[model samples]
Target: MSRRPYKPVMSKTWYLKQPSYRNYMIREMSSVFIGLWTLNLLIGLGKLIQGPATWSQWLALQAHPLMILFSAVTLALALYHSLTWFRAVPQVMRIQIGTSFVPAKLITNAHIGAMVGFSAIVLLATLWGV
Candidate 1:
């Protein structure tokens, strides 16, 4: 008789068992949409490089309802990913000031603030065409 290693049975939805696990899975899954968004942008860049006609067609394609919906979903996932990453930063990065360490909330809040500030700058620049 040959002895075989036993494997424990686990459900495919094991991550759904805990809120943290679910969130982690969602955060990881968000990368797929983010990757799609990156690919979309790269395609647009290529179209732009091809010439004005191709760029115009790409821009028109983005105006479709389906593309708009995809953009919205991707934007939401990207924001969630960013927020989760910012929250985890405190745990992964330890910063000390003299004898004491900075509060985790402070670190997270600073990251959120910076994200907002940079986003605002980008929005303004885009609106101003500068």
Candidate 2:
């Protein structure tokens, strides 16, 4: 195999300049996002347990214009993170069936299907309130 000398790509923009830098940035940013999301869930549990008054405060917080906007942003970020993760999941937990590689599309579709089903369940549960 012939090898070529490595050449570095230089760019004025910090993140776009290096692939490694961009990947590291993504990793760090995702960790922070995941952490914040978990904390948000914990806050939700607190609001639930602290009685309807505290829960009403939480609901009011959710009703705030800023919170609504940030919730959308959070959903977008989570969707991106989940897509990246689901795409790589087949490779991580690869199944062997007579030494053939699994198609990535199948994994993606399965993930999408599961998400849709889960969403439906959550919606129904919320509506029924049982």
- Per-candidate TM-scores read 0.94, 0.69
Q: Residues 6-112, candidate 2: write the lDDT tens digits.
A: 88976667886779677656755776776776787799889999899988888888889987877777777777677677776887876667889668788777997
Kindly report which residue stretches of model 2 are placed more than 4 angstroms away from their true locations once superposed: 1-14, 18-28
lDDT of 1 by residue, 28-69 (tens): 999999999899999999999999999999999999999999
Best-fitting candidate, scored by TM-score? 1
Q: How accurate locally is residue 102 in candidate 2, as Cα lDDT from 0 to 100?
A: 66
Weakest ten-residue segment in model 2 by summed lDDT: 23-32
- lDDT score, candidate 1, position 17: 99
CA shift of 56, model 1, Å: 1.6
Q: Which residue pairs show backbone clashes in model 1?
A: none
